[model samples]
Target: MILSTTPTLEGKPIQQYMGIVTAETIIGANVIKDIFAGLRDFFGGRSGTYERVLQEAKDYAMQELMEKARLAGANAVVGVDLDFETIGANGSMLMVIASGTAVRI
Candidate 1:
């Protein structure tokens, strides 16, 4: 399905509004990854481990969003938005949420 951050897709007219769809994913940092991230923080460098984890979570959330849209009989999702937050004790968990309006084009 097509996914766009804009309200409407160019060239393709929206045929139906299938309501809003949302998906969420939460991931926790492993102890080893946290250790490496802490070392990187001390060395003033980017944490590749954390970056990979965040990217994976975001991808999973987006996939879920697309699945929900498809289940709603939508071929596209418009006005897509992604939100990220850190939760759990000591902010050890990362939460990614994908939301959009399911639409038929």
Candidate 2:
């Protein structure tokens, strides 16, 4: 399925508006990995652990959102929005949410 932040895909007309579709997930941080992340932060480099987790979360959420769109008979998702939130102790929990308007071309 096609997904974009813009309201419409280039060279494709939006034929039907199928409302909003969303998906979310909560992930917990690994204790040992968190300790290593602290060290990485001090050293001032990207944290692979966090990046990997978020990337996975984004992929999962997008897949789910796309499935929803598919169920709605949509060929694409427009105005897509992705969100991340940290919750629980030590900010171990990550919430990934994706939403968009399902549309048919």
Candidate closest to the true structure, highest TM-score: 1
Off by over 4 Å in 2: none
Tens-digit lDDT string for candidate 1 (66-103):
99999999999999999999999999999999999999
**Which parts of model 1 have CA positions greater than 4 angstroms off?**
none
Model 1's C-alpha root-mean-square deviation from the true structure amounts to: 0.5
lDDT of each: 0.98, 0.92
Candidate 1 lDDT at 54 equals 96
* All models, RMSD in angstroms: 0.5, 1.0
Q: Please give, for residues 1-105, the per-residue lDDT of candidate 2 as tens digits.
A: 899999989999988899999999887889887988899999999999989988888889999999999999999999999999998986888999999999999
Give the number of the best model, judged by lDDT: 1
| C-alpha positional error of residue 94 in candidate 2 after TM-score superposition, expressed in Å | 0.8
